[model samples]
Structures are given as C-alpha cells and as structure tokens.
Target: MKLLSRAFATAVAAGAAAALVSLTGTVGATAAGSGTAAAPALTQVADEAPGYAVEDFAYPDADRILAEQGIVLKRGDGHITLAACGSETGLLEVWARSKDKVCFRVSGNGGYLSLEIPSVYGVKGNAYATEVTMTVEDEEKSFDIAKNTWTPVGESADPNGRDHMLVEIRATR
Candidate 1:
C-alpha cells in the first residue's frame, strides 16, 4: 500500500511540473521574439481610449426649432424645456405677437432658458415663481410673474407700449 501511494504522488508531482514547464515555455517563447504578439504598451492603450464627454449647454436641435417654430432657443440648464401648448397642465405660457403662443415645461428646484420670441406681451406662470426679460430696441426690461396666474409683460407692461422681444426666463419653486 505504501509503495502504491508513493507512486501516485510521484505521478501527480510530475504532471504538475510538466504543466508549469509548458506554461513557462509558452510565456518564455512569446517574450523571446517567438512571433506571438506582445501586450499593448500603456501609452498606446491610453491613446486609443475614448475621449471625455463635455457638455456645452447649448440647446439641442436649435436650428430646426428656429426654422420650424420661429423661435430661437439658444441654451438652458435643461430644467426648462419647450412644450406644445395644452399638451399638459401646469406649463408656463408666453403670449407673443410673432409666435402667438409658446409654452415651456418647468422641472427641478429651479429652471432657466435663454431664447428669442418677438413682441411678447403676457405670461402665465405655473407653480414656480417666474421672471421674464424682454428687450425693445436697445432697452431691456424684466417682469416678475405671479404664480399660477397671468401677468402682463414686455410691451403690455411697458409704459410706452413698445414692441418687446422675449429674451430670457427664470423660474424657482
């Protein structure tokens, strides 16, 4: 029985040795210019890595929106977004002579959008406290809108009733 166990252990040891030699031989051959491809260098791997994504905050599909809707949507924090009027309740509404009506959906703790809509006169606020900036010629004016109510803005609020272009909107909950 002792001789049988000793022979089995010797066979197992020889098998393990052979496996180690086979593995090392392949690795050594690869290292010693044996036609096998080497691992990529750190610099080469880094150079092929994907680039970092950077957000410009510019409005997406702005040209299409401007061409289709006749409204210039420049940029925003993604909190305020254009929406079709009456699509849903609780949307901020703007009344303009050039565009007639434009609506925005507001979300998050606060929201802001920079845009251009000519001859704006009235605004209907949502749940947020809203403010709008308008420009007439070289003069600019701002109006604070009452929450969940309509407020006269731009040319309607102007003493001289000059046509005003809506430029920016800011809202806070």
Candidate 2:
C-alpha cells in the first residue's frame, strides 16, 4: 500500500512537470512572434497529492492533553475522545492525579483507547459494555465497569487503596 501511494505521487509530480514545460514552450512561441508580449515564467504546479498516512493508534491530542491536564495520553483507535468531565451527562469520567477528573465521550457501537493518567482510583461509565486496565508498581489489573453508572477501579478496586495509573479502556455494545 505504501509503495502504491509513493508511485502515485511520483506519477503526479512527473505530470505536473510535463505540464509546466508545455506551458513554458507555448508562452515562448507566442512571445517570439511579437516582441510585445512578455514570455511567462515557468512555475512548478502545486501538488494535489493526498496527505501523509495516519497511524491508526496514534493519539491526536496527546501533547495538548499533557499541557492542559498534565496527563500523558498515548495511542488509541480514535473511538474514544477526550471530553469535559461532569459538565455533560452520559460521558465516561476518569479520576486521576491532581486533575479533578479527565473525561472521555464514547461513540459508535464500540470504542477502544489507550492512555496514561497516573493515580486513577475511580471511573464512571456510559451506556457501553466497558472494560478498563490499570497498573501500579509491578502489578497490572483489569476491571469490568458497569454501564451508565459509577464503578470504582484501580486503587479503589484494590484492597489496599494503592495508587495506580489508568492505562486502557475498551467499550463495546
């Protein structure tokens, strides 16, 4: 697929160059007939090629999230999007670190995302069948979240109330 895209781009560039050369020749011929008209300068045509391919798992707002909320969002499939917590109803709520809550809005029939928010202890789910993964120290844990309700996870789920980082969330219809 990558090779095909590159080849297509190369073909487009070659076509543009050919068009420029032909246009320059036409202008030169017209100018030679009468010294009145100035020969137009040769200009490279603009590329109409498509944008670079996107990585499916790349986080779109990782830097912005880190800067605004002090959370390092990693990679996700884009089904889940960051939202303003508690401000809207029916959104997934995540409690982490110093931030009061980092929110996510789920869409489509299912959603899957990976992120990094330290000291997560609780989450409130929406209408999707939800699952979340968290990590603490050398141990990792997974929790099944109740839909349309608040469910304690991470440190809250742990018997010792150990601090943990929310790592991933997957939701399905």
Candidate 3:
C-alpha cells in the first residue's frame, strides 16, 4: 500500500510538470510574436468588462414632460411616476393654477417625488397616506393630505392666501 501511494504521487507530480512546461511554451511563443492566438492582456480584458450600473433616480423623459406639460419633475425613487389625468382611477391628482390637473401613479410600499408646479391649490390623494411640501417666498410649508380624498394645499390652505409652488410629495401605504 505504501509503494502504491508513492507511485500515484509521482505520477501526479509528473503530470503537473508536463502541464507547466506546455503552458510556458505556449506563453513564450505568443510573447515572441508566434502566429498562435494569444491570451488577452490584463488591461484589454479589464477594458472589455461590463461597466457597473448606477441609478441616479432622475425622472425619465423629464425634459419632454416639462416642455409639454410645464411640470418640472426632478427625481424620485421610481415608486412614483407621472400619469395622465383620468387615465385611471386611484391616481394622486394635483390641481395647479398654471396648468390643467396633473396626476401621478404611486406603487410599492411608499414613494417620494420632487417636482415643481406653481400655484398648486389642491391634491386628491390615493389609497396611501400622502403629504406635500410647498414654498411661498422663502417660507416652506408641509401639508398632510387626507387619504382617498381631495385636500386643500399650497395657496388654498395658506392663511395669507399666497401663491405657493408645490415642490415635493410623499406617500406611504
């Protein structure tokens, strides 16, 4: 049994040495400008590797939306998205003096959106509890919107009756 073990070890070592010699010959030939195909350089392989994906959370088609709807949508976590008013039921709706009603669809457990709509007076909330932030002059105010109902916001809710710009919306299930 001892002799058999020694023979097996020797055979394995011999096979490993043969493989090393074969690899070295191939690499040396390639380095010496032989016609055989060569392995890619480290830098080439690295450069060909796929790049890492990054999520900026910027709203898609934002520029087009601003141009067409006069709404400036900045960024969000993708749980909230712009939708056509009356396109579907249960959408969060905003009434702005500067434009016709704008709507947003909310999904997931919660959502957040940063946007700009001037003279926003009211919001129709969906099933989620919702809130909105508005700015009048340099003073910023927040309003909690009643779920599944219309709530006065921004200028309509302000005591001074100052026109306010809707800046943010948050919703939670």
Per-candidate RMSD, Å: 6.8, 13.5, 7.9
Model 1 is weakest, by summed lDDT over 10 consecutive residues, at 26-35
- Scored by lDDT, model 2 comes in at 0.82
Q: Kindly list the per-residue Cα lDDT of model 2 for residues 1-173, writing each as its tens digit.
A: 99999999999999976775576654334434442346568986777866898577878768887897787778777788888766778898887655778889888888888888888888888889999998899988999999888898877778898889888999998
Predicted candidate 1 versus true structure: per-residue lDDT over 20-113, tens digit per residue: 5677664324545464556756654464768889988899999999989989999899999999999999999999888888999999998889
Ranking by TM-score: 1, 3, 2
Clashes of each: 0, 0, 0
Which has the better TM-score: candidate 1, or candidate 3?
A: 1
Better model by lDDT, 1 or 2? 1
lDDT of 1 at 60: 92
- Per-residue accuracy of model 3 over 95-155 as CA lDDT, tens digit each: 9899869999999998999999999999999999999999999999999999998999988
Error of 3 at 4 (Å): 37
Pairs clashing within candidate 1: none
